[model samples]
Target chain A: MKRRDFLKNTAVFVAGASVSVSALDFITPKELFAANPQLKWGFLVDTHKCVGCGFCVKACKTENDIPYEANVTRTWVERYVIKKDGDVVMDCPKGARDGYTTKLLDQNHSGMLLVPEDEIAQAFFVPKLCNHCTTPACVQVCPVGATYQTADGVVLVDRSWCIGCGYCIMGCPYGVRFFHPVEHVADKCTFCYHRISKGGDTACAQACPFDARQIGNLKDPNDPVAQTVLSQRVGVLRDEYGTKPNVYYIGLNKEVR
Target chain B: MKNHVWRPLFVVIAIAIGILLFRAFYVPSDFGSQEQGYTFGYHRLSNEQEWKDYPEKYKGNDYCNECHDDKIEELESAHHGTIPCENCHGAAFDHPDDPEKLTIDRSRELCIRCHAKLTMPSSDRNDIPGIDPAKHNQGEECSECHNPHNPSLEDM
Candidate 1:
């Protein structure tokens, strides 16, 4: 072959190879980049309506296959008794799985006795669970990339991939994350993702007869829970942390943190 | 041109091409961020489906209504209307097909979960009719006198 022709072919091949390197982006499926902007899951808790029945806790444990005997729970209720003297007493015995039939005498283990009924100015139950924050601390702290927030705004932990480093657990401000006794991995609420994705209410929401707990798509204007969240004055737990939690409480009191 | 300059360049280009090819083969097609803004750029896209497929143990009243419409209808009209059927009877997971019948929870503890008197004056729990277990029918099962399907209704 002539030297000139050989030089031209080599130049074209090198340029073509460089151009093909940039085409690597095309290998990734287009669907992975297509974000569904319409759906964003949110939860609402009406503290005034929660009766401390503990049914939601039971349902969550059963639906998620969390060990019944294990003290760890994905969701729980806290009973707060505020004295007229401004001392706030809080306790969540057995994660409120069994009702608050027997009150905890030493809730903080500070050797403080239970305030008598007459000294109490107000008492209420606050159901607590994973906030499924917009900017989740757990997701940010996961070193192994096991925990992530889904497109629909639910934070999920890939149990198989979790290293159980407990960073995510410590990073959480609400103390929602726990190591599964059997799995020995960092675990928390999925917002009952298995049920909610299939057009079913969460196990906790469905078990709540009083309609105190609800899960809904915040993007959907028609959802009653969404309406309540948007139209009414709702508050989230530990807003100062800047996690931007999704769970909204209707009758949240000042005493609650 | 020096052989060293072109030789290293050629080798670097070949290695780059090799790495790209390996990535295409190794990385899953559905492994990446699902959205554009404010998203952590690492996650398995297929894990969403894996979570969605996780079996739900507590099938709500709608599942039971397929067969036990009569019981559902009766409960809906009564005081226990809001309570799920599975709440009292264990989670209707693979019901009738596997267990044939649900184990009815007729324990007094089950009944008292909502009815047990809490002395807190500022709470809404006082709205529900509560009784001290020691004072109310003690030791005897609540189902003996009250029909759990309709708690207000007296059992014959």
Candidate 2:
């Protein structure tokens, strides 16, 4: 072969190779990353319908295998009493596992003020759980990257990867994360990922007789829970933090925090 | 080129290639940052499947209906129709096959979880018939008097 022809052929081969290598950068297989845009999970709580029965709390404990004696809970209900004199009192006894039986305060020394029956104006209950934020602070603050958000808008903690740094527990604005009594890792509500992914209702949602708590696929427009969330005037807890929480509330009182 | 320049450049190139090769072998194939504009954080892609496969403890009422259709019918017609069967009788994780009989919770605490009254003036809780535990049938199991299936029927 001639020397000029050999040089020209070599140049063409190198140029083609470089172009192909650079093209590979733009080609990322869709299957490698499994973030399904079609599915998103959301939760709704109707404070008006909630009777503070604590059945949801009991079901959550049983379904999640949380220690019955542990002081921490994945979900709880708080009773708020707004006095006639504009004083607000809030308490969640044993995470509302037992029904609120008495009108009087059980523990006076706990620094909780006892509102007189005549002095009380109105009272209600608000159920609390992990907000499962779109921009979760727990996910951001995990030093070991153990806490993460699922593709379907649920936050989960990899117990094996978690180093018990407690940064996630501190970083959460909703104060939902807690140390698992047995596992000794950061744990919070998963919105019952096992149940929901299998086309079933969450334990808490199913146990709620009054239909106070409901979970649904937010991406599906036909879902009743999705319709209520999309059409109704709902509010979220602590919108100032910019977490973009997925949990929505109806008839949330101004006194609730 | 001088030995100093050429030798150092060769070492730098070799180390860069070595690091890339190590990463290719060390990192998991199904592990990486999430797709851009999707998830808020990075995670093992397979962990999503791990969570989904986790076994559920609270099997719903449909699982109970396979055997206890008679009790389900009576409960469904009663006032406590909305309450699930598993709520009172623990989670049916492995029922009948493993443990034949499910323990029934007949304690007063279980009954009063919804029936015990509170002082909420404007809430829906007032709509539920709540009895003061202190005044009404003190220290007696609630199931002893009222039939749980049909709570409206009094044994007295």
Candidate 3:
């Protein structure tokens, strides 16, 4: 083997190796995960703003078409009346109308809901929805790979793909996901993807009387949620658990204290 | 020699194309989920708080009042005046545009998702807070109980 021949072969090999490395570096696998709209829809729930109105719960049902008998809530407003004595409670048993409620008038006070009679022991309403977690335990636990995270951070379940195994139901830390009795698939808030995709708001967000529900693209910086997180002292539920949940609670109940 | 060499390569290439074609059209559907959200290691947060967004187009509920003169009046006068139509009834594109292919939540489940009792099997039954699911009927639709035209409870 001549010296020139050996060196030429070595040079070619080095060039090929460098080319492969460059290609690998240039094509980030993250691009494949890129959301076309590049959005992750989520919510910033202001507990302070919520007046314990069951509007969100009602709106979610009216929007999702949940049957009254299912006894399921895609979104629920938990009335927390912290009596001066320090007992946290809800307004009513959350009475019903026909099937779903569009009207969440503040017929709710603190009796069946929460009977509060103190300055410091006053109660507030907190609306809850799917955390739309980044590493959602619900998505992780699905035995049939039914639940999925969208490219833009939205956690979605393909109604067609869901196996109704209830694995997701068990895994959700927030207890928001449920199994559809008829469809037999795990279901939760799609963030109203069908509505939002076509340009609209989630029923819960719209139904909220106090603007307690604010939905936006967490990816977009100009959104009100971004401003809220940037300006206000906000907190998330179970942040220590590390779910990277998208739901933000503004003025979270001091009871967490 | 060239023929022998290219023949196998051509066959392999042909087979690959066939597979591609089969997948493109014949595939019934895709099952399972997709990548979404900020997973722990992927988009790790350095603090107790993070940026959050609402899950809808922030067109501002004010837009609901733009063309809906009569609706705005009724809604404002009704108990739900403060609430946006898009919120309670789901995005009402069909009603506004087509009315037939109504994109509304035409089923009873839409209402049930809210008004029905909340059930959490994983969380402590006593500790967890939500409406009790035992009181409502699972078979009826929202319109069956509440009248859409009048938006009332009178068995319309």
Candidate 4:
């Protein structure tokens, strides 16, 4: 090759290489969740705030496209009925779809038929969902490595990688995970990963008619989640299990499981 | 002996060069930021599309605030500032273009979800003062006495 041709070719190659290299500046560590470490998603369920509306249950089903069946529930609300004898009876019929005020048996009755008032000493509703633990037992037990925690502290299941093993379902101390009916894979709440990551609240949180459930990013100092965590005394479910669940409950009772 | 030596060494050198060339062109530049860098066969899992499965159905609070500035202002100053508007209104998936489609839920059961007294200890929770909805205001909607926007009952 001629000297002039060789020099011209080398110049073009260098310029092209430099341009391509500089383009990588946009894909910095901050862009890919490495340097940007100020976001940890969490949930707060104020038991005092819950009215057993069951809106959270319906919303989660709709958002996740799960079948609206009694057996298949991504989240459920348990109505704990403590008897006068100090016995606690918890039941959630179809995830409380009709709320707690529906007539128990309204056969040809004009007015509302209430639950027998004498049967209960004290009663309250507790909405349950995935805790998204700091040290998730489900992820640890996932034999196929399908269940993993994201950088932002979200526990997610790679459906494509999951082998339908129910190990995660069994390992979760909070009883959050389950084998998805149709998908046949271990499934649980993701803290509404897609929505929360984009600054939107969880389906359950947004569907809560009474603001009983709220999603918060603990890393953001100005977020309401920070204020709720710092100002209030929040408790987790089964703290003795030591899963370090991110879900916080504001008014947990001693008898609650 | 000389021929035997050159053949195997040349094959090894060629294989090394092939791997280097493949990595140079195929591996993502940003993979350097990841802890594993690029684990040859498993690098295919790094596709952005892998984790982008969930659809963005809920249209966040700011989207609602764009048009409902007055309502947003009222809520921000109220005790329920942190509560997003969609929580009560249902998901406003397409309300911007079709405002009439937006359904505002004013059901009494909606209010009762947070207001009804539970078995929680008094010291643990500060908000949502417990009220037996059946007896507190028998057969009356919560909004009859307290405005949802300001909820302190002083606005009534």
* Candidate achieving the largest TM-score: 2
Cα lDDT tens digits for candidate 4, A12-108: 9999999888887545433545633777788888886676767788678867877777477778887766667787656666766545543242323
Which residue runs of candidate 2 sit more than 4 Å off their true CA positions? A1-35, A106-113, B1-27, B36-39, B153-156
Arrange candidates by TM-score, descending.
2, 1, 4, 3
- In order, how many clashes per candidate? 0, 0, 37, 1
Give me the candidate number with maximum lDDT: 1
| Cα error, candidate 2, residue A244 (Å) | 0.6
Q: Tell me which residue pairs clash in candidate 2.
A: none
Which lDDT values do the candidates have, in the order given?
Answer: 0.85, 0.84, 0.59, 0.70
Model 1 deviation from the true structure expressed as Cα RMSD, one decimal place: 8.5
Model 2, A61-101: lDDT tens per residue?
Answer: 98888898898899999888989999888888888887676
Best by DockQ: 2
Give the per-residue lDDT digits (tens) of candidate 4, residues B24-140.
986555333222111111122443245555765567677887888888998888887766677677666566665557777787777765566544332122255767766886788
DockQ comparisons of all candidates to the true complex:
0.35, 0.41, 0.11, 0.11
What are the candidates' interface root-mean-square deviations? 3.1, 3.0, 11.7, 6.5
TM-score of each: 0.83, 0.84, 0.59, 0.62
3 or 4: which has the higher DockQ? 3
Lowest-scoring 10 consecutive residues by lDDT in candidate 2 chain B?
B32-41
Docking level of model 2: acceptable
Native contacts retained, all candidates in order: 0.58, 0.69, 0.17, 0.12
Q: Chain B alone, model 1: TM-score?
A: 0.75
